[model samples]
Target: MPIKASTGAAYARVEGIGAAIPSRVVDNHEMTQFIETSDEWIQQRTGIVERRWAAEDETVESLSLEAARNALAHAGVEASDIDAVIVSTVSHLIQTPSLAAIVAAKLGTDGAAAFDIAAACAGFSYGLAQADSLVRSGAARRVLVIGAETLSRITDTSDRATAFLFADGAGAAVVGPSDVPSMGPVVWGSDGDQAHVINMNRTWPEAVESGLPSQLTMQGQAVFRWATGFIADAARRTLDAAGLAPEELDLFVPHQANNRITDSMLRHLKLPDTVTVGRTIRHFGNNSAASIPIALDAMIASGEAKSGDTCLIIGFGAGLVYAGQVITIP
Candidate 1:
């Protein structure tokens, strides 16, 4: 039997799911206007045909608010009922007041514990783990976890390597108490030594003096090697922590960083063909921290995965960081 909360308190389980994909769809052909890439090349390489780009009015907070509202609505919850709010992102530039504080104010969730986490693409998993701990520890009754990003704001649209990869979006989940722990503990770590594999070319202060945009830069080959080589073991470790086997998973949702990465991990795990895999990158691109939740939302929307189904999610990114967990669909 699964272990019950030692405190006799309820454990955290995902109660609601939501996502916001911008209305502006930019296809590869549209990107060809400035870059030297073609639709065929992009599709063959990233398995992405197009992606959404936020409009001028859609700030990170706005996208997060919309997604948070949707999640609360889905769970039959109200913003005022939220006991805590956590926003995960690398795009929101404010350093003083966290994005979570801003989101809570907009949602009327006054006095709620609010903060932001910077885990890059692994953010949602980290947020989930934190929410679980808070709820299980009797610190919060209900928590709103949102992963939002406006990657386009920092991306260089002309850079062929990254231009077609990153985009803007937000995804959220309402986490609450349950009799059993459906949200497993997160397995995560970071390699600060290899952080240079993917990072901004310069700091904001440096860019201000240089009069250049502080765009994202990456050593694609290095990132690919690290992801494919180490992430499979991370997924397995997460499953083991959850008392689940690869064959028991109903779905596999990794960071929509690249289709190839997902494919490689699946093969490494040797999961059965019945496991539904998330291919959200085809439409959403890589929303960084938002990727896993958005992919989870997509699976829920398409009727591919349903409540009670076990899904494995893995998130990896710029800090050369990674996090994975096994969760029951809500």
Candidate 2:
């Protein structure tokens, strides 16, 4: 027998979602001066057109706080109503106090059990599970989870392969109790086996405060192979865990890692083109943790989803990690 909500007896639901990107935009063609790659090569290889770059003053804390405010406002939930804050990122510039704690203080959401969780690009989905769990266990009434990154900070301008694909941004969502299971059980997995295939350590500064010197390095082809197969497997397992099938889903929100990766995963799942929220990171570049939630905000604002619509959110990133959740809108 599962425990029920205090004032309510029901499952958890996503009340609202919001995303914030920096004002500065970087396009691939502009990479000619910074790297050896051509605009045509970038376009054909990665479906990215442009991405936002953070200004010197724009820190991850600021970006996450802005996203949190928007998510709280959109959800119509008071700051005091939030019981926890989880920030997912690998680019959290600081080493202590936790980025979530700082954002909570800025938002005036005091006393909340704030913390951070890093799963690389799959961070948001991983955090979503944490937030959703908080609601389900009756441990909290509302939880604020944010996925933020500043990949530009560590990107080696000389390394064309990495400098062009990684950028900065943040996105957030609020979860609370619902009248029914508004979201499906998340299915997640890890392949500690494939971790080293995509790593960055060959930069001028050698390395940074933590692992990999903050710069993203990867063998594009190797990642492409791992991504397509891994994501498809996660998707199938997620839908099955939710007790649903591919055709039953109304919308599929996948991590905006790469257009090719997204397409390949979708094809393997046998899902049609109309089911995806694709090409976000392609244009915005891989904002790492922020990718999926940013697309979620866009999908909702565009009215692409409606009441009772089933939306599947999936994320894949470092740790060779991947996860997905099935959600229903109110």
Candidate 3:
């Protein structure tokens, strides 16, 4: 007798998307109170007018749950339909238990396999790649990928460099079986040699010993160079890998790290003028892993993006990591 083998779907597609933006708005004037910067300077440099910070009542878990629920509802999927959950974030704050497990239970999943990934800003695309693989390999049928962050809690408010660049929010997508190819190959890699470009100022143990919290630090000029030069080429390769021409692309949603960076990439890629670029950074700041998906949901809601539109998405951050792929708007 031959051994039995399990078969999965031929392909997987993003079935739904949702986002949870924190209600507390922190404007440039408010940021100036902490950093020695003016509103015009901040806007001209980063293109950020304001960003959202979580309210006292909002937790990473709560935002994740809300985003997940909204995604499930949008997909017309019952909670029990999700067989796996992936939460991507560096803001979970816990060391042992995973946030994905907690979110899965709260969403009423029937014991879905759950885990978390710490890829900094590239996390959402990283999780989506894993979800796509799992679904196509028969390891899971429906996967929920959530990227949530609360950088406000860890931000060094007095640091003039990064105080105004971080924010808090959550975004999610449901990936399910599809008969056609809906997700393109993921182009991703990291450079440990440049790992110091963006990272924490102290280790946890060091923080505990010194009785002071660690804060994120970045080599701004270095990051700008890497993102604009290498990451821009990577974005072009991602679209090419999907067999999509520049003219065929309907949208571009790069990480909301800086508007200047986005502009640089656009120049490098030379994408068509018809493609709508995501500029949510002006309002949301950089929510790390949550930026891409949040921008996707916002575009869809505002009618800037529509179902079936082809979009190219990418993310890059601490770890000096990067990832990009082409996806059909859900």
Candidate 4:
């Protein structure tokens, strides 16, 4: 007997988007109390005035559920309609029983297949790529992609370098079959040699032995150089791969890492002035994986971005990894 192949959707598109911001806000002045930095310096350096930190009542799971529910509602989809769930984050803090599984149950996903990915700041895009593939390959019909982070818990507050850069939040999107091609090819890769540029200060076992919590560490200058140079070129390649000219792009939403880096990329890409860029980092801080999707939801809500707009989104961090793609705004 001959085997049969499963058929799937010809294309996939993001049906809707949503975000969950933490309740507590941490301004630059509060950052100053923990580090030797000033308000003007923080804003001038990173374009961040303040960022949100989770309240005592908020947890990664709760944020994920909120974002997921909102996305499902926006998509006009029931929880049971989701065939799979993909969560991208480094803040789950557990080694097993993945956050995706827990979130799926909480969202009443009807036993949808669920798992998690750890690609640091590039995680959301990475998860999107997987969801697109899964839907198109018939492995799943509809996929929920969530990017959430609670970097505040792992941040070394005494370290002046990163004390103000990390925050907490969650953002999600529902991807389903599309009648037309709305998603572009994903351009992604990693450079393990530069993994040390952004990483934790210690391993779990090491932290346990030393009686200290593992905290995030970074080489800021190196990241800036790589992002502006290599990542900028990658963004250009992403736009080109999508068959879009710089002028044809309506929005540019890169990882909310640093405003200076965003400016440098703008110079490199030479995008026209009409293109709306994502500057949510000024208020949200660098929430790692959640940055891109959070920016997307905000831009759409604020009218800076609209449905059917062509947007270029890219993410890079930690693993010195990167991923970019052109997506039609949902």
What do the candidate models score in CA lDDT, each in turn?
Answer: 0.89, 0.81, 0.94, 0.95
Can you give the TM-score per candidate against the true fold?
A: 0.96, 0.92, 0.98, 0.99
Which should have the higher TM-score, number 2 or number 4? 4
- lDDT tens digits by residue: candidate 2, 1-330: 998645432678888788888878889878777999887787777788888889888989889988888888889988889999999998886778899988887798858989999799889989989888888777888999999998888778789667778889999999888877788888888888878766655543555434455556777777788888867778878888888877888888788878888777777777755564545776678898899888777777778866678888888877788878998753
Error of 3 at 7 (Å): 1.9
Which of candidates 1 and 3 reaches a greater lDDT? 3
Clashing pairs in 1: none
Best by lDDT: 4
**C-alpha RMSD for every candidate:** 3.5, 3.3, 0.9, 0.7
Off by over 4 Å in 1: 1-8
> What local lDDT does model 3 show for residue 194?
95
Error of 3 at 226 (Å): 0.4
Q: What's the alpha carbon RMSD for model 2?
A: 3.3
Model 4: pairs clashing at backbone N, Cα or C within 3 Å: none
Judged by lDDT against the true structure, how good is candidate 3?
0.94
Candidate 3 on 1-330: residue-level lDDT in tens? 999877899999999999999999999999988989999998999999999999999989999998898889888999899999999999888966999999999899999999999999999999999999999999999999999999999899999889989999999999999999999999999999998888888999999999999888888899989998999999999999999989999999999999999999898888889999999999999999999999999999999999999999999999989888999998
Clashing residue pairs in all predictions, respectively, total 0, 2, 0, 0
Which tens-of-lDDT digit does each residue in 113-210 have in candidate 4? Answer: 99999999999999999999999999999999999999999999999889989999999999999889999999999999998999998999999999
The digit string of per-residue lDDT tens for model 1 on 1-330 reads 998654524678999999888888999999898589999988888899998989988989999999999889878888988989999999997776999998999999967999999998999988998888888887888899999999999999889778989989999999999988788889999999998888988888999999997878888888888888898889888889999877889999999999988888988888999999999999888899888888888889889989899999989998988998888899
lDDT value, residue 213 of candidate 3: 97
Q: What's the lDDT for candidate 4? A: 0.95
Is 1 or 3 the stronger prediction by TM-score? 3
Q: Which stretches of model 4 miss by more than 4 angstroms?
A: none
